[model samples]
Target: MSTRTDEVERYEHLWQEPAYPHRWVLWDTAGDVLVFDRETNCLVDFDDESVLPDVLGRMRAAGVPESGDYPGRPCA
Candidate 1:
């Protein structure tokens, strides 16, 4: 998402899952770009296959900034 060369920081947008606003849970967005669950605070390799291209494709079309890396399952 934001890792794309076409994307920029500062103006870089932060993305989140709104349905769980009170949960403080971050979106595990690696599944949308890389197949594996990326660990918390880790940098993601955008070309990884763990991502779901279909979802990214749709969101990219809507101009939504891709989410930042997040914690995987069992986040404490």
Candidate 2:
């Protein structure tokens, strides 16, 4: 049986691949951006504009396209 750590490792490996599936971006009411990884049920919140470039870089590394704007449902 796989432990939780093993599952997490698997997800991490998957995330390193190009065009990893089920990854999405969401905007909060406050206008911050959040990266949602469906496979891992993880949310990476970007609360500062200064970190946007870094965030975008990470997104690209994860095979998600970079866009000036992302259309999606707002987070409550």
Alpha carbon lDDT of each predicted model: 0.36, 0.48
Candidate 1 lDDT score relative to the true structure: 0.36
lDDT of 2 by residue, 1-76 (tens): 9654443443343345546344564334345445554444556543344555455455557666433354344545
How high is each candidate's TM-score?
0.25, 0.34
Which stretches of model 1 miss by more than 4 angstroms?
1-51, 71-74
Candidate 2 at residue 70, lDDT?
42
Candidate 2 ranges beyond 4 A from true positions: 1-16, 24-30, 45-52, 57-76
The C-alpha RMSD of each candidate to the native structure, in angstroms, is: 11.7, 8.5
Error of 2 at 51 (Å): 4.6
The best candidate by lDDT is 2
